[model samples]
Target: MWGRLWCLLLSVLTATAVPGPSPRRPSRELDATPRMTIPYEELSGTRHFKGPAQNYSTLLLEEASARLLVGARGALFSLNARDIGDGAHKEIHWEASPEMQSKCHQKGKNNQTECFNHVRLLQRLNATHLYACGTHAFQPLCAAIDAEAFTLPTSFEEGKEKCPYDPARGFTGLIIDGGLYTATRYEFRSIPDIRRSRHPHSLRTEEAPMHWLNDAEFVFSILVRESEASAVGDDDKVYYFFTERAAEEGSASFAQSRSSHRVARVARVCKGDLGGRKILQKKWTSFLKARLICHIPQYETLRGVCSLDADTSARTHFYAAFTLTTQWKTLEASAICRYDLTEVQAVFAGPYMEYQDGVRRWGRYEGGVPEPRPGSCITDSLRSQGYNSSQDLPSLVLDFVKLHPLMARPVVPTRGRPLLLKRSVRYTHLTGTPVTTPAGPTYDLLFLSTADGWIHKAVVLGSGMHIIEETQVFKKPQSVENLVISPKQHSLYVGAPSGVIQLPLSSCSRYRSCYDCILARDPCCGWDPSTHACMETTTATANRTALIQDIERGNRGCEGNRDTGPPPPPMKTRTVLRGDDVLLPCDQPSNLARASWRLNGSVGLSDGQGGYRVGVDGLLVTDTQPEHSGSYECFAEENGLRTLLTSYSLVGWPEPGPAKVPSASDPSVSSPGQLVLLRGRACRSRWPQCHRPLHGPCAGWS
Candidate 1:
C-alpha cells in the first residue's frame, strides 16, 4: 500500500519536472500474465490489538536460523520463515515510551502506525547482534539488540543521519565491518547527505547540489563490491542506487526553462578514502557517480524502488525490477533489466560531465587529466603517480571532481533486451534463484510481485518466456510492500497490510500428470515415471547432478500419458421431435480450447438438408428429422495439435399415430426454419390444429 501511495503522490511532481531525452523502443515482442495452476498456503504472524498495519514497516530475513525479523510501530517480532502458522513466534516489544508516542501524535501524525515509534531500520551487525533504528515519535533513535536473547542493551546509539525521522522518508544504509554507510536527508530533511559512521573523524560527503545527489525519491540497494581486478591496496567500495534529478545543464542545445527531470543513477564511495588533509577533511574525496540507463524502449525514465538481486560470478550480474514512466511522471509499464557490476565500474572510469562555455554544452572533458583520476581506486600504481593520498590531489582536479561528479558514460544493461515486460501492470518486486537442470544447464526462475497483491512465477527458456503461474498472496488488493526468500530459497516471504505469509516457492505436487509436470520446466521439479506425478527432485540434501541433469524441457515421452490408445465409445442418442433443433453438449475448460465440430457419421445432414450453427456455448443443429440422426463430433486444439474432445447423436422421435398426429400441412404448425418456442411445442403435442407455424390463423390448413 505504501508503494501504491508513493506512485500516486508522484503525480504532484509532474507539473514541475522537465522532460528529458526520448526513451528507446522496447525490444519485448510479447507480454503476458500467464494464468498458472500453481498453489500456495498462507500462514499467520504475530497480531496485535492495533491491527496488522504495524507489521508492514520493515522485514529483514536471516537464513541461518530461518528467522524473519519484523520491525513495526513500537515493536520487533521474529517469525519462522518456513511457516508463520498460528503462534509461530513471539513478538518482542520495543516501541517508544509513552511521552514519545504522545509527542508524535501531537505533531499531526496518525496515532496508529505513524505516530508510534516505528522501527524503520534493521541491519545485521554480527552473528549475535542486530543493529536497529526507530522513528522515535519523529525523533530518530538507534540501538543494538541481542539476536539470541532478543533484548536491547542499555546503551542507545545516536541515530542522527542513520535513521529517518519519518517512516516514509527516503533513506538507505549498509553495514560493513561494524560501520554504517547511509545516504539520507540531513539538517531537518531538506539537504541530502551521505555519511559514514562508527569511526573517528567519520567521513561525510558534502550536502546535495554541492555534491552529486539531487531530489531523489528512494533507494533500492547499498551494495558492497570488490573487484578481482583491483590493484594492490584497493579497498572494496559501497554503491547506492536511486532516482535523482539531473544536474543543471546550461548547454545551448537545450532550453534553460526546462524543469528538472528524474534519472536513475548509481553513486559509490571508497571504503578506505578517509578524508583530505585540509580541503575535504572528514569528507569522502573518492565519491563518484554515473547515470543508469533503464528506460522502457519508447518510454521515459524508470521510477520508484525496485528489488535488486545479483548472480554470482567474477563480475556479479544484478537483476533489478523497474516501472516505466512517461514525460508526465505517471507510471504505465514495468520491466526487469539485468546489470553487471563491472559496468558500473566502467562508467566511473569514464570522463566527468563538465559545462563547456565555448561549445555551449556539457560534454567530455577537454581539459588536462589528473595524475591519478578522481574517484579512482587507490591502487599502488595510481598511488605511485604523485597521488600518494586523496590529500595530494591538486585543487584544480578536486574542484573538477566537486563540480562534476557525474560520469561521462551511462550504465547500460548487460542484455540489450529486458527479460520480462508487463504493460498496464505495476511489477513492484523481483527475486530469483538460479536453477540447474540435471543436464548442467542453468536458468533463472523469477518470482515477481505485482501491485494488485499477486505473485507471478516465470521461467525464461531460450528466446521465449513461460509464465508458469500467477498466485494471489493477499486476500484483498493490497500492493506487496516487500518480498524475501528463505536461506534455502524454497520459501517466499511476502509483506502485506495483513501479515506476512510463508509460501513455498514451487508446488510440484499440483501438477498431476506427466505432461503438465514436464511442461512446467521448473528446476525444482521432475516427472517421476514410477510415481507418475511431479516430484520435488531438486533438493539441497540430495545430489541433484543427475536428477535435474537431463531435464525434459522439450516435454518428451509425455505422449504415453495422452491416452492415444483408442477413441471413446459412441455417444448416447437424444430424442427430439421432428422439425425441432438439436442441442449438443461440447464440454471443455474455459479459454483452453477452440472447438471444431465435424459430422462423423453422415445421415445426410448438411446445408442443403439441415446444418448446425456454432454458438458461444455449444453446437446447435438447425433442424431435426428422423433421417437427420447422425454422429456429431467436437475436436479441440491449443497452442498446436488437435485432439478429439466429445461427440453427440441426435435421434428423431417417431411420427405420432393418426389420433395424435401433428399435421405438417397445418398453417399453425412451426416450420423447421423458425425459432423453437415453448408454445410451439405445446401446440404440436396437444393442439393439433395449430401444430404448424402460426401463419395467419392457420388459413392454409383450413
Candidate 2:
C-alpha cells in the first residue's frame, strides 16, 4: 500500500510546519514635532541685543541707516542693526504719571502691569526727531525725541486719537507733514475715529447713519508717492486695511445667513483733504472704502492677518498675510495673498452707491454724478480752476460725497491662488526679501513667524511653495509680534513678547550630504563639490547642479544615483521561539504616502495566510516555526516614488520573553509624530499617527 505510505509522509511535513508568532500588532506611535530644525547653538557668534522680554509689541526699522526701534511696556529702545539683541542696547524709560495710573486703576485696569505706559506708535518725524506715542494709563500721550541724543527732549502732548487708549487695541498710522494720520478709537473703544490728529483741526465720528467705518480694525498704512518738487495733479493718499462686518450700507451683502461673518476692507483718504465747505468741516472729504477679497470657491475664507505697504512707483502691488479657515471660524490655514493697485483704482473709479431713504438700503447710483466726481483729489486741473481743497466744493456735492463714500465695487485679489500657504502652522507675521540665485534665477525668500515661537523659512517655486526650514526663536512658546527682513545682512529679525531673535537666511552647513543640501530648494543654498560638505558657496558645476530634482520627495539628487527612489536600507536579523509573536515594522516617511511589503517571495500577508498578519507597528508573526524563517523587506512609497526602507531575516527560535522586536516605527523617513506605517503597521481609528505602542495581543515590544 504505496498510497498509504504517501499520505503518511505528507502528514509528517504538515506536523513540522510551525507557525510564526501570533499577530500581536503594536499600537501606532505619533510624532508631534517632526519638522527639520536648527538649534540655537549654531547662532553663538553674535552681538545680541537684550530687552526685558516683556511685550515688545511695536517694531520699526529705519532701513536707510539699519537702525531698529522696539516699543514695549513702559520703555522704548533704539538697537544697533548689526547687534540688535545685544544686552547693551539703548533704552529710554517713560512710564505713566501717578495721576494717570490712578484713573486707569479706577477703570478696573491692572495698574502695575496693564495700566502702564505702552508705546504703540513710533515713526520718523524728521531727520533729527522721532514721533512716539504711548497709552499713558489709558490716557494717550505723544512726545518728540531727539535722534542724536536718543532721548525724549520735549514735553508730552495730549494724544487722544494719535494713540489708542488700550494697549491691546488694533490700529495703524503714519506721520505726514508733521501731522499724525490715524484710524482708531479716539478716547474709548466705542467711539471709532478716523481723523487727522493735529492741533487746531478736529473731526469726530458718529456711530450711525453714514456709518463710514465699522470700528475698523486697522493693520498698516502707506503714504502716496509725494515728492515736493514734482507737480502731480492728484493729492497724496494714505490707505488703511481692516476687517469689518457687512451691513445694508454696502458690502458682500447684509445676508441674514452671514450676520456674524466679517469682510476684509481697505480705505483711503486724501493727504490734502480739508473737510467740506459748510456741512463737514475739518473732516476728510475724500475718505472712501472698498472690500478686500481673498475667498475661495468652496466657501472657504482667507481673512487678512497683516499687510505690507504698497510700492510708491506705480508697481500697483500690495502684499498681505491671510488665514484661511471655515467661513465661520476663519483660522484653519494661513497664506500670503497679493492685491493689485489696478483693482483699487477700478473700485474707486466705478459707479457709486446711494443710501435709499425709505428702503434703508444701499443701491447702485443711477442718478447724475457730482461735477468732477465726488472724492476726486485736488489735481493740477482742479488747482487751475482755483479750487485748493474740498472747502471750495459746493455744499450739495460735499453732502453727496459723504453719503456715498463706500465704493460700489470690491477689490478682489490679483489671483485666486496664494503665493504661499501653510496648513500646519498658524502664521502671525510675514516679510519677504527678493534675491537672485547664483544659478541665474531670482526668487523671494519669505520669513514667516508663528504663534508658538517658530519661524518657517520658505521659498516660492513655479509649481507652488515649499517650507525649507524652521527654527525656534524663543525658549518658550510665544507669538511672534513682528518679522523684519534685511537683504543686506542676510538675516531675519523676529520680535516676540519674550525677546528678539536674529536668524541667518540660510544654514547650508547643517546639511552634510549633497543629496539633502540640494533638496532644501532654498534660493540661498546650492551644492559645492570642493569641500565635500554642503557649503554655502554659490559655485556649482553644471553636471552636479543638474543632479537636484523633485525637492518635495528629496530624491533624484545624487551622482550616479539619479533614480526617482532611494535604495533599500541595510539588512538585520531577528530570532523568534516557536509559538512566539513578532512585529515587522512597515511605516516609512511621508504620511502623504502609503506602504507595502513582500515576504519570502510570497504574496502580501492576509487572512488564510496562517497566523501571519499586517499591522501598523510591523508584521506580527505568531507561533513561529522553521517555515517562518525567511527574508522580509519594508518599503515606503510616496509621490509616486517608491523608496526602500529596511530588510530583515527571520531565523531559528531563541529563548523568549517577547520576540526581540522593536515597537517603534523606523525614523528613517524623516517625518515627525509617527513614522509611516510599514507593511503590517496600521493606523487605528483614533490614532492618526499610527505610532503608538501595542501591549501584547497580550504583551509589549521586547
Candidate 3:
C-alpha cells in the first residue's frame, strides 16, 4: 500500500510540472541600427507641443478639419495639424476635484501623480463632439467635448467599464455606430473584462469560475465590417488584441501561474451579439479567442499592433511588434510579424478547446460540437436555419460557447516567421503607410518607434524589410505612446510623454546624390534627371516621366547615363594652431558602405594606435602638428566603387601673440581669426549641395 501511494504521488508531481522557457536564437533578419541616424537637434521642420502635465498618451487626427487633438494628464490640447510649431495651439485644463484627491490619498494612492486625472480614452462620438474618458482620482469618469470650442462641461458619466481606474494599466476601446466596445479592468475591482456600453442592453463577459480574460493587458481594438465584404451577409466583428496568462493547470498557485507564462491572444465578438434569452443573459454568446503565434515555442509578448487595410479584404494585413519575454526588459529583442485577415478568420472557424472536468486539464474537444457552430455570427446561412440573432440561438449552442471560448488552432504569422527582427531594441508602437512609386508598384513603409526615443523607417520588400533611416525624435529616452500617419498632410504625428511632434513623411532632400537616392530603397523618393536632385514623388509633379526609382536591385537602375559620375567635391580650408586637436567631419550617407579618411592621397592616418581615429560621424585628429596638415578626403566605398564625400585642406599655424589663448571671461577680447578657427573646428554633418561648381568632377573618387 505504501509503494502504491508513492507511485501516485510521483505521477501527480510529474503532471503538475511546468515546462521551462524556450531557447533564444540569434536574429539575422535586420540590423539593430538603421542606415542613417539623424539626431533630434539636427532635424529641420520638426514641430513640437509641450503638454501641461506628464503622460501625453492619446491622439486623435481630424483630417477633414486639419486638426490634432491630444489627451494628456490634467489637460487636453488642440494643435494645427499642418504646422504645430506655429505656437498657436488651444488648451483646456481638466483636473480632478479636491475632494476626489483627498479620497484618493486616503485610499493609499500617491497624491501628486495618482490623484490627478489622466485621459485614457478619446473617441469620436459624432460630427461635432468627441467622447473622452479619464482616470479621475482613482474614479473613472467620462464626458463629451465640443470639437469647435475644445471644451467640456462639469457633468460626467460614470466610466467604470469604459476606462481603467489606474492610469498605469492598459485599456483600449473603439466606438462603432453609437456603442462603445472596451477592454479594460473593472473600476476599483481590478477584474479584466470586455464589455459593450451605450447600447439598448449592455453586455459583458461572463463571471464564471473559468475567467474569460485572465490577467489581460489590452493593446489595441478595431472594428472589421464583414458584412460589406461578405456574400453571406455576415454581421460585423469587433476584434481585440492583448496579452494574458495561459490557462494551464500546474503546481504553482494562481498568482504564480499568472506571472509565469503569458500568451498573446486575438479575440473577436460580433457587433450584433445580443444576450441569450435563456442561457447566457447579458453576456457575450459569440465570443472566441485564439493564440497569436509569432515565433516558435511562443515566447514573445505583444507590445503594439497596427493594421494596413486595403480595398480588398484579401490584401488587408495586420502588423504586430512583439518582444521576447524570457529575458529582462532592457535585453529583450523585438520581432515584427505580419498576419493576413483570412488566416485569422480561418482559425476562428476551426475547432474549439474545452476543459475536462475529470482530468482538470484543457484540450481539444472530442465531443460533437453543437449545430450551426457555437461562436458563429448571424450569417445568411445561419438565418436560413432559424437563427436571426444571438438571442434566438438554442440553449445547447449557448452552453457550448460558455464552456469553450478558446479555439484549438492558433493564427500563425506570414511566411511562418517574423518579417523583421532586431536584438536589444524594444519597439513600443508602429504605423504603416503605402507609397506608390513612379514605376507603378506600391510599397508599404513601416515606422517603428522604440522605447529609447528613436523611430526607424523601413520599406517592405518581397523577402524581408530594409531599414531606410532612423530619426531621434526626443532628446531624452521615452516610449512613444501613440503614432498616426497622414498621407494627405504628408506628415507623421508622434505622441509621447513630452509632447506631440510632427515629422515629414519623407525626407528625400537629405540624400545628396543620385547613387545615394537609388540605394536608399525608399519608395517615396526618386531621382529627378531634369533638376538633378532627389525629390519626393508626391511633390515632384512637374517631371514624372524623368523620375527614376529602383527598390529591388539597388543602384543598378542608374547605370547608363547620369548628370556626372558624382557631385564635385566640396573643398573647405581649415586653419588650427599647432598642438591643438582637430576634427574633420565626414558624414557617411549610407550605412551599408565603409567610410575612411585619406590624407595627402594615402590612407595612413586611420591607424587606431596613433593620434588619428575614425568615428561614426567624423575623423578625430588629436595633438595636431604641422606635419598633419594635408589635403584630406573622406571616401565611402560600396560594391568596389569609391565615392568622395568631402575634401578639407588642413593648415597648421604657429602660435602668435605670446601664445595667449582666448579666455572665456573676456568675450570682447575674441578676435575674427579666432572665430574662424573655432568655426572650422566645430564640425557639422550636412548634405553638400551639388549646385556649386567650385571644384572639378570627382572622377577617380567615383
Candidate 2 lDDT, 1-702, residue by residue in tens = 534543443333223212322212210111012235655554534334556547787778877777788888888888877768555567898888788888899999987676888888888898899889998899888999887688986577887768888887777778788777877775774666677866355554333456787656677677756334336666677777776655444324335535566667778887777777676777777877886665331222333343333435364456676655543342355656666666687798888877788876667788888776787788887778878777898777777777887777767655444455454457667777665665455665677777687777776554345677677666667788777776666667777776666677777666555555655666676555544555443444444443243343444455554432345556666655565555565554433345566677565566226766555445666566778788877665543445567777777455455433333443232234322222222223323333454522212322
Rank by TM-score, highest first.
Answer: 3, 1, 2
User: Per-model C-alpha lDDT, please?
Assistant: 0.62, 0.63, 0.77
Give the per-residue lDDT of model 1 (tens digit) for 1-702: 545643543332222222432225323343555735333343223222223445555788888787888877677877766666646676767777888788878878877766666676788998789989887777788888998888888879777668777676667777777878777774354656778887665888765336456776556655554644544766677777777766635343223432465667778888767677766777788888776765342233443333233322243655666776554454466766666777777788877787667866456666776756777657777677777767777776666666677778778765444555566668877666667666577776778888888888777664445677777765567877677766374777777666666777787776565545555567777666554556776653344432321233434545655432125446645555666554454543223346666775433232323445554344555445666576777665433435565666656666464223334343434344222222223422432232233321122221
TM-score of each: 0.76, 0.75, 0.82
Candidate 3 on 495-546: residue-level lDDT in tens?
8877888999889888877777787889889888778888999999767657
Q: For each candidate, C-alpha RMSD in Å?
A: 9.8, 12.9, 9.7
Higher-ranked by lDDT: 1 or 3: 3
Alpha carbon deviation, residue 101, candidate 2 (Å): 2.1
Alpha-carbon shift of residue 35 in model 1 (angstroms): 4.3
Task: Choose 1 or 3, whichever is better by TM-score.
Answer: 3
Q: For candidate 3, report its TM-score.
A: 0.82
Which of the two, 2 or 3, has more lDDT?
3
Best by lDDT: 3
Output the worst ten-in-a-row residue range by lDDT, candidate 2: 23-32
Error of 3 at 444 (Å): 1.6
